[model samples]
Target: MASVPSLSASIQQRVADALGADPLLRRSDRADFQANGVLGLAKRNKANPREVAAQVVEALPTGDDDGLIAAIEVSGPGFLNITVSDAAITRTLAARAADDRLGVPLKADPGTTVVDYAQPNVAKEMHVGHLRSSVIGDAITKILEFEGEKVIRRHHIGDWGTQFGMLVQYLIEHPHELDHEAGETAAGEESMSRLDRVYKASRKLFDADEDFKTRSRKRVVDLQAGDPETLALWQRFVDESKIYFYSVYDKLDIAIRDEDIVGESGYNDMLIETCTLLEESGVAVRSNGALCVFFDDIKGKDGEPVPLIVQKADGGFGYAATDLSAIRNRTADLHADTLLYVVDARQALHFKMVFEAARRIGWLTDEVTVKHLPFGTVLGKDGKPLKTREGVSTKLEDLLDEAVQRAAVVIRAKNEELSEEVVAARAAEVGIGAIKYADLSTSLGRDYVFDLDRMVSLTGDTSVYLQYAYARIRSILRKAGDAKPAAHPELPLAPAERALGLLLDEFGNTLAGVAETYEPHKLASYLYSVASALATFYEQCPVLKADTPETVENRLFLADLTGRTLRQGMTLLGIRTPEQL
Candidate 1:
């Protein structure tokens, strides 16, 4: 299929090139599209509005079969309510059906994008807090890649800091602490279990024994100083943590590679240099023995300036220092045109200051743009942050497992004869997709409630609904023996056929917008609208049992295209569509 230029875009360009002004075109509620730019253009040129609209209308290309614009009426001042011909819609869709891209165009000038997301801490279980970043970031990456953008995934896990000193020192004391049986080490869950036990024991000893605390603090200094022994011990913790991270990612069905697992410690070598550069450049000042970057507009509760501390007074580097160094590596070394930090919304101010500080140091300049794609917390049904009865954070694995379990029940009811293995397999797809769809259905900046009941339901905006819609279409096509889908643009179309065709024609335009804005929710909403229109079409227009063979084939063509569109869209969002119920 070839890339199809949208009807609105064609008209807008025609109007703009003719009048040499912005077209300001919008999809009309009552008409196909409305061009409201003539009113402004007329005022600017000191001409009559209706007369200017007439000139713009005359500029439109005229044709009977291939002409994009069918009717253009200039009414009420200078508003041009335009309608595209049904023939044109069918013709464009025919082109789309012939291409693998489904008529979506690759970016003319694609650039590198580094996405930082799915951060988890060392020697700890992943919680629901990390869910949004992983899901949203995966979708964004997929969407960007589909658009031909060079996407780099950075896990940015929490695999560094003074805490490692305690774990390492404890491991040193108990040399076989992290060592498991030959069979056990192969399992990620078993690896996590060993780490959790060691972590708890280390923390308990570090807190209770005075001498151990001194040894642990000294280990931190040794680790930072690059002592081979301490550094080697720290590496063990990092490697072990990745095992757990990979397991959780696998369960979620996200493909995370080992090479992309760059944590905070990845910037360790450059931290000191980063601080030195800031101080030398005078972007940072030594205040109370700490290197700090101050902003006039940023203040504390006492009306005093709150500076970003690059280094503590105790001669230790802070997160800001590590992040500044990361900017240099990502922008200068990676040659990334865009840097995206998919972090928590609470870190907005920290990123603002960090990015500003990076700009001051000339690391992030005109050639590169950075954005902290902040996301809100996932709340429970009670409208509070999700947590267990003991107030501990809900484990991400547990949440995912529950979703799959609930989906199995739904699948079982739909098909009682399904084997346990098949039911479980389909359940994972539906359950995982439900969680992802619900998260993406809402705007990235808004907090969303996590309700498995709503997410796994067969109706509404859930992914299950979309999945079933695709499956139903597949079923219809399978049942139509020897009835191949064939397009007939010359045949008169019912209103339902016309409506579905118009919506299908907008796929390229809709995806282009979503990819450009880095907003997956927009794509989700667009897909939902397409699915809804498809439902209406199916109900009103019979495919296999139509009165005539040509009409049946034409309706089947519409159904076939709709299924392909849904599958393509959902795949971009990291969701799977099963062929059966």
Candidate 2:
């Protein structure tokens, strides 16, 4: 199916052709759209603004039956306030409603993007600090794929380093520490519990026993040297950590494939080569026995240049080496044209240096687009990073559980007759949806309070509001039996109807903006606007009851399209729209 041209786009083109310049058209309260480009066009050509506006308006067609512009007037400073015909709004939306994609067009030139996110360390539990990266990355991935871009997901778990050596040595000595019974697979919680136990016990022994500490240090050398026994034990830790990671992702309603779980160890083989390349190319110089890449703009508090250390003075590689290696693999081997990192805001400097280093080494070039999408912290009510009462980081699983519980209360209070099973199912959708919406609706690099009360509220800008809007439309359509939704181009539209119709036509344009900027909040705001418009439409115009049969059908048609638009938009943001809430 062909994509539908929005009324705004059509008007902009017409006005641009008449003025012979780009019409800076934008939605306005004075009219359906207002063109401000005439002011600039007139100034450049040394003509009166009002005269240019009049000439453009005179060239445009206007009529009640045939013209797209129903009326046009000159506002202050030569602004052209244009009102599009009701038929144009209804006609454009009808085309969108007939298509499965809602007339959203695919990108003409899409490229492969490797998105690195959802990083969790092995032998450590996930906390609220890990929430933004996972949620934001998941939403971006879905949005890009919807735009026909080839997206490659990477979950860079921390499964390597000297810490693993201690874990492997402990398991070797105990021999049964990480072992599970026959025919028994360790669940996510159990896996974490077992790994935690081993970690704590080994740490206590390593700190108190000098001999054990010496042995642990030696084991690191063996592990790095690829000793089979040591490597086998290390694999157990990685496997166990994955079990825990998957469990949390499942609860959050995010899907993560096993193959995409590439951690630091995945690039171990390339670390030495990556460092050698940088040193040979003069991109990195040895400073005090450490291979480093320094930038002029990045300086420490003492005004000394801060150099990104690729390899430590002890001949061990650091994160910079692994990251550069990952860049090489993604661009050269995977043929990716774009690289995205959804990480903490604090890591901005680190990535800045890493990207510059890659550019200097010729791994990242002009042909590749690399971006580091930094996000802010999740604060508590006290304007501090969220933590438990014991001052420990709040666990991700526990936070989700609490959200679901709160959602169940809200769902039950709304409808006492709903079965427990139904309530449970809907609560999961609403609760998780609320968390995701709250995170996604806020602009990036801004901290948000983790308040379940405000999140599950029925009145405000939350997922609950949008979910109810969708459910209400579905109810109207169900009662709309024997009366099918049909577009009536000849029927006059009410103010509310015209408003919704115009907003529905902007769905494709909204998505295009999101894909270009990699922002999910824009899509969230669009859905909220649609819901608000639908609310007004319901209040002003009756769907099942109207003066004429065609009026009722026309309103129903608008309602159906609104519901579909809300569903599609929510889905693109990795949110669910339950039919009944």
Candidate 3:
């Protein structure tokens, strides 16, 4: 593999030689790059288009720059419409094949990023909504890590607040609810189901009975005061929730570290001090006897200004208080240069106010970047927010389980030779990949359908398609046996090979954009393009049955590179591409 010049660099050199000075280069449908600035250069120099273009062409490097510039023509209105050769495309792809990192460079100035995601409230059921946050956040984490940036994951689970009080009070009344000998319960199912039942019963009683509500309220105060018994009960609720959350994450094939989970309760101590910092700075003022920050742009239907309440009139800290404190800790204490909140789109207003308040007090300055990656809802087939047939929000675990089961059916039908264990493992990958890919393939701000059939289908823009493409490439390589993949520089290029090479060279450039935009969907789109191009190439070019050994080796090399690129790209998107899938 020979060294390959970057597309942008190559274009810039051609333009400079042809038109002189800085020339704007962009991808176009008409040509590789339409140098519209050529006319401007002629205007400035008071010369004709042909003469200006001739000088620039003469200045273009000769010997080594042969195939890179196929033709540089002076088009309508003095536009320098340029077209590149297949040789240039192949050389660039060869360069990418030489690098382990796929020719992608790390950011020049990477910073520590603290991301808040996967926040399901403690002692409650996690719905499909939580899936969006976890899936999106996980993809972002992978992409950031690929760019060689430091990423700190914070689950920000809702493990504290008045709800814990109700749960604790109920547990105190019935101490045997969450109590069961280790072996008495089923490995994973029975334990979680029992906890779920107790939680529902406690919630019903707490809501209907006035006396029970009062006791629950007092339990909150006791729990906050570090009452030993109440604290122990609180711990049980958290432990049970973790078991359930872990099961869901496992089914999704995503790893969530135990130590990284820091819920709202974790920021309890800093809440008061955070409020004090805001008040002292005059960033927060007392509104209706409650500490709040009002924004001129945020208004209700009645046209009254909306305020983000830091502290309620009853002296209780709400969600805002905890998040503001978290910002302070992440920036001042953790030394994070980038703060990312991957939450539901519904909480956009809360984050907007929190970020504004954080900036006002200097907790977040111009030097620190804060972003709220707000994602839209997951709708059912009816285009409404996803819910069970009975109208209740579906549990995250149940949804994932069903998706995996559906995937198993597809896998069994397609590949009968796969062992039971492989089928099971592949089912989890395909199911979870379907869900995560569905969320990531689209822009983060839009609603997407949750359809298992569509996700597991072998065709279309699904993970199954990409995985299958990868598996096919691997199979081809295996069939090639000991015949090594050696690039044949002398071989002529086919149309499909040229297209694949051009797309392959863009891997690094696309990743650079993804890192800058914080958009994994862009990377997803790029991977889909690579797979699509490979499919076309496979149909056009013969690998094992080629006319010559050299052509066979070159085609095999191309297939090997495509497989590696697909596998690596899918891994970065948090999707597994099984070699035999």
Candidate whose TM-score is highest: 2
**RMSD in Å for all candidates:** 1.6, 1.1, 2.4
lDDT of 1 by residue, 329-421 (tens): 999899999999999899999999999999998999998979999999999999999999999999999999999999999999999999999
Model 3, 1-581: lDDT tens digits are 22345776688776775555777776666766676676677888798866777667666653346767776766676666676765666666677778887777777688999988898877677789889889889988888888889999999988888878888889889888887686674334555776788889999998899999999999999988889999888988888878777877877777889888999889988888988877788999988889999899999999999999999888898788999999888988889999998888888888999899888888889999999998888999899999998999988888888888988999999989989999999998888888888889988899998888898899999999999999999899889977878777667778788677767777777777887787889999999999999999999998888898888888887888888888888888889888887
Q: Predict model 2's lDDT versus the native.
A: 0.93
* Selected candidate, larger TM-score, 1 vs 2: 2
- How displaced is residue 102 in candidate 1, in Å? 0.8
The candidate that achieves the highest lDDT relative to the unseen native structure: 2
Q: Count the backbone clashes (under 3 Å) in each candidate.
A: 2, 0, 2
The Cα local distance difference test for each model comes to: 0.89, 0.93, 0.83
Cα lDDT tens digits for candidate 2, 46-130: 9999999999989988875455899999988799999999888888888999999999989889999999999999999999989
- Residue 272: error of model 3 in Å? 0.9
Better of 1 and 3 by TM-score: 1
Residue runs of model 1 more than 4 Å from their true location after superposition:
17-20, 58-66
Clashes of 2: 0
